[model samples]
Target: MALPTASLLAPGRVVPPAPLPAAEVARAAAPFGQSTMLPRGAYQDDQVLAWEREHLLDGWVCVGRSTEIAPKGMRAESIGRSGVLLVRDADGALRAFENACRHRGHELLPCGGSSQGTRAIVCPYHAWSYRHDGSMIGAPGFREVPGFDTSLYSLKPVRVEEWHGWVFVDTSGQAPDFGSHIGQLESVVERYDADALVTPVVHEYDVEANWKVIIENYQECYHCPSIHPELCRVSPPDSGDNIELEGNWIGGNMDLRTSAATMSLDGHTEGTVMARLDEVESRTVMYVAVMPNLLISLHPDYIMSHLLTPISPDRTRIRCSWAFPAEVVEREGFDPSYAVDFWDLTNRQDWAACEAVQRGMKTPSYEPGPLAPSEDGVYHFTQLMARAYQGQQA
Candidate 1:
């Protein structure tokens, strides 16, 4: 549950947001035409930013990998307007909580490296120490204060769940079952044995574009023939097809031609063939978009995950990781530069396009344009956004 903002603020200083007029919200959620796009303000408005922080990012969203704060470490991360502390307790279980101190709302830790072997989360402001389980154990001078109760001040928890080693947090604790939300994806990826894949490389990009723009760019291939010459040559533009799925999930497969087995510069498989894939499945590439933050790409030889964190209405930080079979990555002299270079080059190209779109949207005359047949993914994505903002559950 969200904390009471009124109590946290000074007397008579908190101003509640006026409810949006029903007609305006209904218009905002109306389905778009084949040629129409969301209004430009949706990409760069202050109101939209506030709404997203409260409704979208406050729900289950990817923060980082489990290994980053496993066993005995504490890490700080931000999701929308919330500061989160990811902790691995003495019992060896992963947990998450609001980074604010229970007593005075001071940030418990600054952003950066994980603190190793941290036994408790201590607030520098008052030296109030909390065990890994978030129960308050020590509070200097507070023991002498009459009626003070440590039980009433245990750190507030943020609901957390892990999937195949990836960690996600839901600040509102209202998100549906994580497995049920992405079950279709798990069924398809189970064959690849992703749990056995070891991440050997991770890349970060600071994109000057709205988070939705980045996601929309990822869902379509209409620009492939023009912007991604190499990618299209290896996986033809016509090879892209959407996979039918249930719930808020969207995904599809792109066929790599007989001449191309991987997405590298030479279009050849450089790593060991993933076991269990048949001849046809061996050459196919799959893509899945987990709403709000994650974009997953599955290949015959490896897998890539993109986690998008929105910094503002027009800025996003994207972290990309490439994971390969443990056996292959563990091989001596193994180098993933071939696949990394290809994607690194493609990522730059995609970011450039997204940035250009952001610059264009700033024009007062800019308006939504018609979407091509290949942009069906973007259409589906916009629908999801509309529903989310209109107070409909995903």
Candidate 2:
């Protein structure tokens, strides 16, 4: 079925945002070497989070890998205040729709729920059904109405785009085109051939920290020597350069120690190196934080991703996954624990630190602090967020 225009499904109402405190804006706008972190209220206040949900989180937000939903399968996601349903038709085409049923607006699938072999999306409230492509198929007891027409009540469509293997959705339907949003990052990751990779391990964490806190943590490694001993042992904490690229993302690469082969507990890997990586890529790990919600780490042997879902002002849900080449996963006695266990430990340590920051944000004496010289990525992200708070684009 052809999708309906975004206008058909009313655009999200744009509410005027409360202005940020002058001091906060000034702090965020400071030069990198002189800049400080965003104010505590930015991380701890409900109104600040509401502004973010309306502004920063409106664009292309990553939900998960496209591989998670199979043909004739459906997965539900919560994007800002809207619930979206991702469906894979029998023909293998991926589609998305507002999760609500046409009648009474009951949710077709609860957020975070998934169903396999879903031939029809049947609403539990009244059994109204929709095809995989979101066209209305049946509406019980509605045909008797004076002018009831099934064609006029098809489920509303939401914009969904799949880049490589990752699935992104635009709930607001008002953001820039997906290609524009992804920008030059495409050329950078093209060599990875991520679409051909398979994720063998997935970990979920309920972190008691603001979403930005977790992202800021991912963007810097100044704390690696202190918090992530294992990670620091495998990759040098000070050996990397931040790339000034043309994309809606920020990141750089950290060289792996010569003695280490990959990011594993033993600093070695049985897996084969990815096919297209150059010599530099083979020796360094690239960490890219896609604006707002996704973190991508590219290693010689595999790829790791973190998808962030902001639960509230001070809570975020993180889904972490590790992907390896299909051939590597199919090898005899193939085991992912080498990569998984290493990251699981590293991830928990990072989460603990983030939680500490969240708690610290509540302290009455807490205030924005200076960015270290090594925290260039953090400074860039902070500036972008500050512009967002002031209703300006970076």
Candidate 3:
């Protein structure tokens, strides 16, 4: 929920912009040669934002690939969307909840609180705590109260399902099964063998662009040739075309010639695995922006996850994780330099480009440009934005 504007106002005075109320203008409108049914402002509207917060943001979305929390558990949150807590229980079953204490509305995990093998969630505000399963364990001074009911005070639990070692949570408490909602992505992701992978590095940055800008950037390769020189050199330029667009999702493949890159995580680079990329002509990398904010990259040898969290109307935080094979993890000395360096440089280039674009769009002279027939993926993405805001798919 948005904080109130009046809270910062002086008792009897006003600040700048008092002469004019904030105006709503959709930025960078583009015609797809299909229909002009939606406004660009829909991407930035407070009303539409509110609607999304109530509907989609409240609904389940992918959080992290299960590989991040497999042998040991980790913490996750949706931030403004909502706070979600996912932990592997004693029996090792994964559980997700609202990340809160039922009493006094305290956040269960602040500053990423850690749990011993036994200590579960506890409220920092009152010291009340719960079991790993989100069941209320103890709330001192409240149990003896005549009207207090522990049965109704368990921390709120969210719907969670692990698919392809990825953790997904729906906030509306009313989303279709995680696998079904993602369609064929389930099978496609499974082929990657994600569950066996181990994370080597987690890189995150905040970019000065709307969440949509980052999503659109990842959705197409039109800009790849110009913005990312090394990436374009590694992956064939102009090779990315929309292969699938389902509802709010977009996916495509980038063609790249692989190097000997000898050595799998297991140090068994001598086998067919090490030779697969070398033997192949133009290995391909797959990227999908699962609408809203979750963007995932499945490469020939490793996987990267980009999770976008909107900070404001024109800024977003991008969290990325580099994951690889587990055998290499057990080996314990593999440096992330091999895979991490490539993505870090590529993402930096993208951030620089997007920050400039955001500044350009702020000008009054800018207009929604026309989409060439070849740029259908960008067109489709904007179309979904319009549909999501104005058209109810159901």
Weakest lDDT window of 10 consecutive positions for candidate 2? 1-10
TM-score for model 1?
Answer: 0.89
- Compose the digit string of candidate 2's lDDT tens values, residues 154-255: 999999999989999888888777877777889879999998899989999999999999999998999999988889888989998887666678888999
Superior candidate under TM-score, 1 versus 2 = 2
Q: Which is better, 2 or 3, measured by lDDT? A: 2
Ranking by lDDT: 2, 1, 3
For model 2, the stretches where C-alpha displacement exceeds 4 angstroms are 1-19
Query: Candidate 3, which ten residues in sequence have the lowest lDDT sum?
Result: 1-10
- In candidate 1, how many Å is residue 119 off? 2.1
Give per-model TM-scores: 0.89, 0.95, 0.81
Question: Which candidate, 2 or 3, would have the higher TM-score against the true structure?
Answer: 2
How well does candidate 2 score on lDDT at residue 178? 80
Model 3 lDDT tens row, 161-205:
886667777766655555446766654566667776777688879
TM-score of 3: 0.81
Predicted candidate 1 versus true structure: per-residue lDDT over 1-394, tens digit per residue: 1111111111222233323444444454445443355667678877887877876677668887776786778998988787999899867698888999988998898754468887788998999999998999979998789999899899999989877767888887766667655656677777887766788899999999999899999888888888998898789877767776664467778889779879887797679768987776687788888767998888889888899988888999999999998888888989998889989999999999999999999987886676676777776776666545555443
Backbone clash pairs for candidate 1 read 35-370
